[model samples]
Target: MAAAPGLAPDAPLHIVSNAGSGSKDAHEARQQIEAILTAAHRPHEFILIDNPGELARVAKQAAEAAVRSDGAVVVAGGDGTINAVVQAVLPTERPFGIIPQGTFNYSSRAHGIPLDTREAANALLTARPKPVQVGMVNDRAFLVNASLGLYPELLQDREAYKRQYGRRRTVAMWAGLKTLLREHRQLIVEVEHEQGSETLFTPSIFVGNNALQLEQVGLEEAEDVKRHRLAAVIVEPVSTTELVWLGIRGMLGRLGDDERIRDFPFRSMTVRLLSSGKKRTIKVAVDGEIFWCEQPLTFHVAEHPLSLLTPTTVK
Candidate 1:
């Protein structure tokens, strides 16, 4: 197997595998990845991590090792795991790769990384390094998207529901519906962007770094990811019936036609909560991980682009 451009064939590859990812058999996934690397005659080291808290520490160590040896780090897990590793790898400017084993591999898919474990591993041999822009919320980096209001609430409830029941689409949908019906309070926020400043009364706000995912949800597709901009979709304040209708449209992939759903592009923005005496901190879901960040929250493109190894066919 040929190595990617600028990457030496003899250079070692460091792999961090999350054993608790959405994959049915993490052990099998790790074995398959190792087999592919071995067959290619690549020097590699693999580590399996089950706890999320330890991911940052392990990945940081791997990244440091990679820097000294001029190697790369491969993360085999879901978006959340990838996001965690990204936080550590971005600062080091090390070459990064991913094997999508998540329930929603939005980040990987957006970058054209193969979802199949074997295919993804094979692609790595010939993939090329590309600089992809990343989105930042406060101090953290998110590869896919982040949101507030009803969406965040829904995500929180979905995890609780999943814990009681099981990880299922039906359960997630039910949780979202329940959250929407129960949490009817609207948020009044002041949004300041490159365009201008505007006050909005909304129930939800979605900020996306991946245009393909946004397009799938009926928002306009971004012409370029390297533009270092975010695509935002804000749900305008509406009656519960209208909100339900908007949800139906989103589910049916017709949200683009819904007037209540506003879409725009921004290089940077500030979202300030107008509710008096509201908590200084609020929950923001970044790549499916919940984080409580101090408001007024700021969103912007990162200063440096991620050095990603993607399939040659992706470009």
Candidate 2:
């Protein structure tokens, strides 16, 4: 824990909003948020993001403006959208807020923020900034989780599927099944963690920083998260049928007892690419966005906890 960032009673809000990131009607959500702020006589500005490429720049601008104006930077989008803003604001020490607009909003749900964007907007008015831990990978901040290997590929495929079949959870699930059944490459990596180091043949290595998410996925590692340690799940190589059955077990809250997967807890971990040999570049999915990062990648708790604006004291 750290000192809380003080908020002024009438501080202005610099909100970085992506108008089309989630399934909700952004226009109506924005209007309702504006109405709340207007009724409360709070001055605010929404920095609308026009495209995905503009997210980083928009977040930087909002964070800088909030710092200069003694206000706070608020993000109205999904986990990936908020991750960009967190990266920008963390270095500047600007107070940050979130109006949840995505499915399974891990960060917001973990902090006890309202799931409805409009309700979260109203809560933002009286919220106070609290220091909260965030997971960091190769200098990028992820509030919930960061992963590599087959999981990243699944996310990439899911995005492509979303563009083709529409944005729905069922569509994402179908995409995952398609990716799983298709021929996949194994990830050979040298993992250096607290316990020891080993070259594990696995399809995906998932590192979770949020207890709620890990628990929902039926992983006992969620308890590790509660103990202030990062939880990791490594999916060992298995037949396609077994893999599908494993996924079903996960959905049914039986993954914790499955022998096909190995779970561990660590304060920090380093991963080096072994399969690619000379090529160190790999696709990593942080939150829900995918990007290329040159290995070796270090996963650890950030040096400084983010100044998150929550409706109540964060657990």
Candidate 3:
């Protein structure tokens, strides 16, 4: 692990620590950060945002601070909290710095930030920030991919399932397989790709700006699987029996280059919850955080994206 990046001699920084949302050793990590800052002779302010609805407010304050001091806005939390700050943030004078302390911190991990708090903090302090694309669902910022149908359903029971199974959480995968077998629910997904408009009945759909390549896919490199286009994929099943087989296939990571599972690249995609009311309520999960919102959900790539400091050279 390295020390926190030295500020421009006597630079000011604003740190907003999300309360009750990080790993168990957050306090010790903060102490380490404070010690580093003190040793570097850098002046900083630490605000523990603990009140309800205070995250967004504090985020805005941090952004404003970044603008005023021309320094960095640093956040310590999990994926959801990170997503909240990313969404709330505006283009500022300084870049955003992150320390991953949440469950499934894939964004941080994907960017090559260390899972350990102190190591990641050190990397952020020293590394050069790189610009990366950010996705917007109806103008809501997201760091990773978004999903519909079975994903929302599966994630809905994630907490309950996690608690019940604990270390044996693979049970959720089995349960999802069972849901696929017993419940023959099909969603009417209308996708407007660069080619044209096509509607299909899918069990689930994923709108991805990037793809996590698995070994079953037979790829050594997990490069920019996503480009200016979004990947729309469906794991379609012919019947209830076939649905179970498909789930098993997906779980075993065996379904690769199959016709039933297709990926379409598009610059934009819109999803409408067909059965829902005027409110257009659909469960949308972005970067592992779930929320209920009505659709037609509009997703597009943001023009001016943030600079994510990562270990990789790829933008």
Winner by TM-score:
2
lDDT of 2: 0.86
lDDT of 1 by residue, 131-193 (tens): 888899988899899998888888889889988997766887777777766647888899999
Return the lDDT, model 2, position 4.
64
Each candidate's clash count: 0, 0, 5
Candidate topping lDDT:
2
Error of 1 at 239 (Å): 2.9
Q: At residue 25, give the lDDT of candidate 1.
A: 76
Task: Tell me the lDDT of model 3 at 59.
Answer: 84
Clashing pairs in 3: 5-125, 78-102, 280-294, 280-295, 281-294
User: Mind sharing the TM-score for model 2?
Assistant: 0.94
TM-score of 1: 0.91
Model 3 per-residue lDDT tens digits across residues 1-315: 112232354556577785554545767778877777777666777767785378888888887876788677777776667777776553552566677876656677666778787776666556555566677777677776778777777666665676677423366665566566656578876766557766778778766654452223422222333444455666674677776776667666765555577765566777766545455577787766787765778777776666555543324
What candidate 2 gets wrong by more than 4 Å, as runs, is: 19-24, 313-315
- lDDT to native, each model: 0.83, 0.86, 0.65
Worst 10 residues of 2 by lDDT: 18-27
lDDT tens digits by residue: candidate 2, 1-315:
577689896999998887645435877788888999999999899999988898889988998899899999998877888988899999988789999877668889988899887789888988988887778888888888999987888888998998999777788888888887866678888999988989989888889998888888788888888776788899989887777777778767788788888999888999988898788688999999898987999999887878889995445
